[model samples]
Structures are given as structure tokens and as C-alpha cells.
Target: MKPRSRPTLARRLASGLATLVVLAGVAVANRPMVAVAGEALHTYQINRESYKKRYGHWARLPVPHDFRVNAIHAALLHTGKVLIIAGSGNNRDAFEEKSFRTVLFDPGTEEFTEVPTPTDVFCAGHTFLPNGNLLVAGGTKSYEVLEADVEHAAGVMKIKNESPDHGDRVFDKGTRLRSPAGLIYLTRTRVTVPAARKVTHGAHIMVHAGAAEVWVDAEQKGDGAVVQDPAQYTIDGLTGDDAKNLYGVADKITREKQEYGGDRTSYEFDPVAERYVRTGNMRDHRWYPTLIGLTNGEVLAVSGLDQFGRILPGRNERYLPGERRWVRAPELKRYFPTYPSLHMMADGQVFYSGSNAGYGSDTEGRTPGVWDVERNRFRAVPGLRDPRMTETSSSVLLAPAQDQKVMILGGGEIGESPVSTARTDIVDLDERQPRYRPGPDLPKPARYLSTVLLPDDTVFTTGGSSGYRGGAYRGEPRSDLFNSQIYRPAENAFATAADSTVGRNYHSEAILLPDGRVITLGGDPLYDETGKNAGTFEQRIEVFSPPYLFRGTRPTMAGGPTEISRDETASFATPDAARITSARLIRPSSVTHVTDTDQRSVAVDVVPAAGGVEITVPKRAGLVPSGWYMLFLIDDRGVPSVARWVRVR
Candidate 1:
């Protein structure tokens, strides 16, 4: 594992209570706080006590031998299971465990099962295929699985270059932690007795448009697999480190400083054939660029910094397979300095968020801005919500009553850099006089956070880069074991979550399990520097769910009990209604063939004030649970609303 810079000092210990609230109630979100965006869904928070745990209440999955957690990546399987694959791990200290192993977690069972971590190369930011499989691409060209004789806890993944150029891939030697390495995809499927294994569906889709432009791994080896020397005969300009120093001049540099690239790479994979094939070339040179899939089936390659490590001027292009031509979008407001986010709304609008560009006081390239998908530029877009660099200028989205209100939950003066503020201005695209709603604040700075829609309308966010990057080689790093937290819809806040007990930084991924639990995997990475402050940390996979979802975890307090009942579909809101201790619902246990969508919708229902309300349950004959079956619960403000899971015997 590469070392990251250590925090000279720790920011005041993350406020626990503050963490819970800031996560949910930020004084202000990203921008256009209150925006008339789309329909609204009831919101809920991920705060509950059962999940908070009392005794040895929290259960951690046992990681494979030798894997120290570098980073963990997660994806939701359509079958209500969350599969996790841990990224490359580095052995930092004799005391610190080695990572780089992968695991799978069954949130409903509150169990963590291990899986296979590709012993080939390091990777992240790969595409999540429409199918359940995950697509990983590029990291170090010198990536090689350690020799079998090496101890599992060994820090070196130095595989013997025996086959040399035939089987498996290799990471570029001396590659930095942030350097791009390998890229591959994984899918999950289920088949009935008579059927040829049909993939029912999945929850872990939606990552920059179904693998657009097939960003080929330029460093991949021919390994005797080459029909063509340089498969595509195309080469990129970003070669990783020379003997351990990627992204900069090498130890043995001539004059004029050395430049990367020239190494042949390919990012092509055939979905149907399940084989990788070389294809087209990128419009220009872009290292670590953001890729977004447009509704019309076109892929957008956003701007990236230049070889000199300077923020390139605003440059973005559109690539469509059929066209084989690159059309330019509005010259980006500025170079997408780093880790830009490209979001696609349900309504077809492509949201392009220009991440932090190096500081520029000049208006033309300074504070970040947004661009609407210029009509005909590529395709028609329903709408686009720009990132607000200014506090008051950003529009905001509010929490709606019915599921029809499209409210803005986050936006503000938060820049792409590490040090960002979370203020909010709500914008109702449909409203004339839209006033922004100022919420709470983040317990600590969060960047590159992932956003997901909860049944109750609130959003679930977790695992992002923390600390502020002052300038070129200066920023804070993630240290210690910190479990990521959940964001609530009702309070419009964020809170300390349970499953985030393991460390993860940079490029880690979180997927919502079918039963409402979150399976987080990947992130066993070191920083660009030989310091311990960069990249995602931890390689262990953990599942985070409300108390009820996982059995046997609750506060055994004698505070009587409050119960919610709904045979088919149940609901409730969090941080409201007596901070959910254990929210469970059950249907007829006698019916085996019976099935139903146990979606839990949470709303504040004021029933006759029984010290604890015992709501009645509903049943749909044999189609539903015949007897009684417990539904999932929320603790730790764990879930903003009720989260449902299926039970089919």
C-alpha cells in the first residue's frame, strides 16, 4: 500500500451528536437549495438506537487473511443482496492489518461473506454494468498478485512475471496510489430450474452511463492475447510512475522533465460477447477524466487537468459510438480540476458538476459553474441543476409532503476542493419566489460523497474524501477507523452511522441492499504520496442496516414498546416518531408461495396516543404473509423512513 500524508493534527474529534444532525440537517446544502426539480417522496432519517448498539451489539465481518483494508467498493444485487469487492490494500505498519481482499454481505442476515479479489491489478471508478456485474478499469500497470509463497499479510502484491505477457495483468511499477491501473466488470445473476439463469434485476446500476467510450486500459499487456501489438494502435499520454513516482517527473529524468503516456492501453469490453475488444480513440488527452452517459445513449467525456498537472482550460467533448465523431459541449466553465461529478436525473437531464479547478480569481475560470445540454449539441435534456459556487445564488430543493415534490436537499458554497462549506439555497424550478432553506452543517468536510434515493424521499450519502486541500500538495487525510454515516430526509441532516467502523477513503463505493441495508466495499488504497493520508482505506466489506433488518441488536431498555403494523406495506418516519428503536413488520408465515413488495414508507401518523401505539396489520389473503412476519426496523436514525425487504420461502 502507498503511504498518505498524516494529519499534522486531528480536527476536533468529530462531534457525535453533531455528526448525526449535520448529516441530516445541514444549515445549507450544495445549491439551488429549494428547486422545483421533480416529484417529492416522504423522507426518513437513518437514526435509530438498536443500530447504535448497546452490548457487543455491532457484528463485524471477518476479513480474509492478510488483507489490510485499503478501500471497499459495494454494489446492490437485484436479489436483495449487497456484494462487496475490496480494493488493493497496503501493509503500513506491523500493527496495521494488510488489506486488498473482497467480501459479500447479506444485510438481512447481518452476515458478511467473503469473495474473490482479482489478483491481477488495482482499480476503481470502473463502470457498474446494467447487469449485476461490476466493471473495473485502470490503476497501476505493475499490478501483480503476490507469489503464493509470500505471507498473506505481506504488503507486496509483486507477482512473479512468469507468464510475462500472457495471462493476468500487471500494475505499472512504482505507481502512486491515485494513479489509474486495471479496469474490469463483474455481474450477478440467478436462474430458475427451467430457465437459463435469468438476471432478475439489480440495485447497483447508474455510474456515468453504462460504460461509455469504453475507456480502455491503456496499460493492459498483450500477454500473447494480442491480435494486434497495440490492440487499438492507440496510446494515451499518462504513463504511471517511473519506479514509484506517478503523476510527476521520474528519478531518472533527462532534461525538459519526463512525460507519461506512449504505453498502449484499452478500455473496451463487449457486453454480449463478454470479451474485450479495442475500439475508438478519445477526442483528446485526458487523465482521470469524468465519463457520463446521456439519455440519448451518447457518452460525455468531461475535461481533465493536463500533464504539467495544471488545470486545463474548460474542455469537454461528446462521443457517440454510432457517430464515431466528437462534438464539443459548451467549453466547460473551467478545467474539471479533479474528481468532477456527472449526475443523471430520472427525467433525462444530464447534470454536469465541474469539480474544483485550481484557484482562478478571473471570472472566466474561477468559481465553478454549470452547463445545460445545449439542445442539438447531442440530445434533448429534461432539465439540469447547476452546482452553486455562491451561497445565495444556488437554488435549493425542499422536503415535499407527497412523493411528487422534487426538492433540493443539498447545495452551497462547497467547492470541489477539500475545504468546502455546506450552505443551502432551495430552488423550485416551478416556483417564482423560491427561498433557500438553511439546514445544519457537516460534522466534518465531505467531498466526492455518493447520493442515493430513499423510499421516504430523503437521500442516503456516505464515504467521500474528507479535509480541505489548501493548494497543490497540501490537504488533510482520512485516518483511524471511521464508519460512514447516513443522511436523513425528514431533518435534512447527516449523522454518525454504524457500519462505517472500517476505514475507507477515495473511490470507495456504497450500494443500497434490497432490504434497505448498505453494502460498502473497495477502498484499500494508499495516497499519491508515500504518506498514509490519500486514497480509500480498508479492504473489509461491511453491511449497514437499521436494527430490525439485522436480528438481535436492540436496547433492552424496559421502556415498554412501540410497534408499527402493516401486513403488505408498512411505513414510518425517523428522527420523528420516538427515534426508531426497532421497526419490524410481519405478514402470514404460513404461506410459502406468497410474495409481496415489503416497501416501507414512513410518514408521521398521529394515532390515538397510546403510550406506545400498536398499529394494526393489513393482509392480502394467501398472496401476502399468511401468519406474522417481522418487517425491518431502523435505529441510529438508521433509516429516515420504513425500508421493506422481501420474504419468499
Candidate 2:
């Protein structure tokens, strides 16, 4: 009865299809869909060829030497090479060894040449001058130590023992001293003890003398002994933690005062010679300042820690390129957070987008607003959500600088906080009342992101972390985000690009090369695969080729003017002039810490000429600040040619 009837082939097939349909339904039901504001967000279609075409390809370049100098700062020089500044390499031992470093990386040759750094330029701010020189200001002098020193007058009660030139002595802990002496004694009493004495039993002493408190074993040194002169007891020896504390304190103080005073030492690095020449020092010492090129061509140096490690006073300074000196801009009585992201507006005023590289508090210039440098006033611009998430964030002046729109993206809370945000917002400064409006959200939350304005009027963003700066805190070793995306303003959308092989986080940089490829290098992910701290100094370099590069043969620039005047038609030879669709002038980047305000792309009207195309450079200084730019000719297909260097004067 059980084998009475065997099912037909068609019946068996129907049963299998039913099972498949049931499993498919279950999988679909369980699939998670991302939502924004209770509304399901649509994942835009990723055209692999289109993605590969637009985002380009990435290739890792071999590091020339085992350069331990982590690229904490990087800039694209007019000479076509990237300047990498490491400064002390972020290692205390390296800093003590005077291992401060800088490197010149030639993208064309894929070679690296070591450059000499006169001082510890670590954590400095820099921008490109009109003449194409990079003006680097502020840097680490010396890191503060945990232990400190104090002087006190304590009576040396007796010389308990003597051995040749060295001797052991006792001091009276209860001895009463004078005003200043008592102040020191009271402050250091419980924390430390007199590790060294200025005088021995035989030496003369005033009623009171100086003493230094240090960590030492009180049981071994014993108490004070009566003596005619406490000054006579010379400190010839120390032991245990006292020796360690004294050595550490002395080393820090010495370096802080002597070798690490570069906060006030400003310099201009001549790209041609690849050497840093001394420039006029700033009015105040700066350790993490933001140097922004104003529309007038002068550089405004704002914020930074002073020599004493306090936020620099509200009095900022302006660097006169002609005078090569920094003058106090007392009239511009505004302060900003360290590495504040500032963009020049059409009216010659500067806008702080509330994005900083992790320094300064809300009261001390962390507010977002448009600053009138002339009138010395800040007009607050509302609508930026999560002000606390601005640290390590990035901002960019949308393409065709004439639009006068700025965008801010991706940041997190300061000081090793694990929280990050993918929030992006844009504001139109040209509007009567400018305020930020929500822009496209990032694929994921990130910090330390580098945004590059492309020739095709698109913004290419890459390299960041989901954690704090470089994901160094909270055991986030794999926090580096290799995914890259391109923001198209025309559609107000973000298109995903190819993922990079290297994890670039804190102390990393990405700059657009003259040939249109992007060179990304350096990173410190807290630790490397070797389980050694050495990997934190990421030295490898990777180049990303965008989709346009894969398109048909690139257009060629036969001949073009090396320099052009504002509002004038500039003619350049192009075989595909008839096919040429757009012309752009991209300012070379001098970027660091996601605070590159100088890099902007200006769209120019192009018309076909006899054998080339005639393009007009914008007359507005704010639209196209006078500087060397990489000029590109794009065909109708959006394929850009190798850029020709042009000076917009």
C-alpha cells in the first residue's frame, strides 16, 4: 500500500519549487533594511563599471625606506610632489632622539626623498601661499610630563653618613620655612619629598634655603638632623623612584625650554628647493593653529596652544606674504578651534563650518558662523546638528566656488571618543540668511575623512575611521574605513567607489596628483598586525585612479598659457576642443587633519576656438584665490586630461 503510486516527474518538480519559494520568502522577511527618520532609505544602484569608472582603482606603492615618520601632515606642492611632515613621529622615544622628519614623495616617479625638518613640526597648521610656497606654522615643542618640580627651604638636620665625594643626609620634615618656601613645602608635602639638598653639613646656609621635592623612599633617607647651615649639604646622590622622577622631570623641562620651542618658529617651505626657510614668527606661540588663505591672498593664522599649553589668546595674526611676517590682527578679535575648517566667501568674509581637528572648546571658538575679518564680528549660522561631533570632521567648498556653498561631513566627539557620525550638511553663503540644510548622508559614520574636489565638479572623499582619530582608542584596531565615495552635487547623491587596500586613519593624508590620481598615505591605527607599536607608523602609499581614467583616451593639452588674468579668455590647444565640455581650475591642496580650505575647484565657461578652447577665469578673488592651479580639459564624456600648471593672477 505504501508503494502504491510513485509521483510523476512534474509532481516532484512542483514540490521542489514550493520548498524553494518558501525559503526565499523567509529570507526576504528576515533581511534588514536601513532607515532614516523612520523612512526606509534607498540604496542607490552601484554600477560596477560606473563605480570603477568614477571611483577609479587603487594600487599600493612600496615605501622607499622603513621610514618611521608617520605622516601626521601632508601637502601637495606646486612642484608635483607631496610633502609629508611627520615631526617627532608621535613616539616619545623618537622625539627624544630628534627623529623629527619630513619627506618629499614624487607621485610620478613613485619615489620618496627625505627632507630635513628644522624643528618638531608635528601637529602644525599649513596652507599654500600665492607664490606656491607652503607656509607651515605651529608644532609640538615638548610634551608635558606627569611629574613637576618645586623649590623649598628645609633644614638639613645632619649628615648621617659620608662616602668620598658622595654622602647621605637627613632633613627635618617639620622645619618651618618663609613665605615662598612655605608655599612650596605645603604644595608638595604629601605628594613628594626632598630628593636633593643644595647644601651639606659643612656648608653655610641662610635661615632658609631652596629644596626640590621628588618621589623617594622616606624610610631609607630618614628625617632631618640639626646643622648650622642647611645650604652646606650638597645633594650628591639619589636612588629608587627619586632618581627616575628627577631624570624624567629634567628631561622634559630641558626639551620644553630648549629644543621644542618651535611653536613661535614659522617657516616657508620652498617646493622648488625642498627646504624650509625661516619666516617671521607669529605674535603668539601656536601649537595646533589653523592657517587659512583669505580671499585677499593673506593667510589668517588662528587658534592653537600657546607655549605654556593654553589655548592661544583670542588675538589672532595675519601673515603678509609680501612682508613674510605675521602681524597681530587685533581688529579681527576672534578665536577659533584648532584646525578650524574655514572657507572664503564671495564677500571676502570667511566662514567657520564648526569642523575642527580636535581641540578648543565651545566657548573658545568652536561656534559655527561667518566671520567678517574687516569688522571683527561673527554672525552665527544656525542649523548644524550635533555640534559636539565636529571634531576630526571635514568640510569642502562645493565645486564652482562661485556658488558660495560649503559642506561639512563626518566627525566625532573629541579626545578618543568612540562615537562618530555620518551627518552631512551644506549652507549657501550667498543667501540673505545662510543656514545649513541636510545633505546626503555618508554610507557609514567616520572621522579623519579627506575630501578632494575633482575636475568633473564632484567631491571625492576617502580614508577615515569609525572611532576616534585613527581609531587609536577603545581597542579599535580594525576601525579604519577603506570604502570611498564620490558626492555628485548635480544630483545631491553619494556614489560608492572602490575600496582602498590600506587603512589610513590618524596621521594619514590624501592629495590629488597632477595626473588626476589621488595619492593616499600614512596612518596610525594604534597598532599593526605584528603586535608591535611599530605598525602604528603607517608608511605605505596608495594611489587611486578614478573612473574617468578608464574611459577612452584622455584629452591632451597641446599648449596653454602658464599664467592667466582674471575675467579674461585663456586659450589652450586641444585636439578635442570641439568635444571639450568643461574647463576647471583646481587649487593644489596643502591639506592636513581634514582642514583643507584652500583647495577649491572653479568652473569656467568654455568655447571652441580655432585649434583649442577659450576659457574665462573668474574675476572674483573669493571665487578663485590667486594661486597656482591644476587646469584640466574635460571631454564631453567627462574624461579629464593631465593637468597643466597655471598661475591665476
Q: Pairing residues by index, what is the TM-score of model 1?
A: 0.44
Query: Which segments of model 2 are wrong by more than 4 Å?
Result: 1-51, 66-68, 146-179, 183-262, 470-477, 527-535
Model 1 lDDT tens row, 489-587: 566566565435554444455544444444455443345333454543445666565433444433221222233222422233222345444343322
**415-438 per-residue lDDT for model 2 (tens digits):** 668888899999999988999999
> Distance from true position, residue 67, model 2, in Å?
5.1
| Position 459, candidate 1: lDDT | 44
Estimate the lDDT of model 2: 0.74
lDDT per model vs. reference? 0.34, 0.74
Q: What's model 2's lDDT at 40?
A: 16
Kindly give the number of clashing pairs for every candidate.
Answer: 164, 20
List the lowest-lDDT window of 10 residues for candidate 2.
Answer: 248-257
Taking all chains together, each candidate's TM-score versus the true structure is 0.44, 0.76
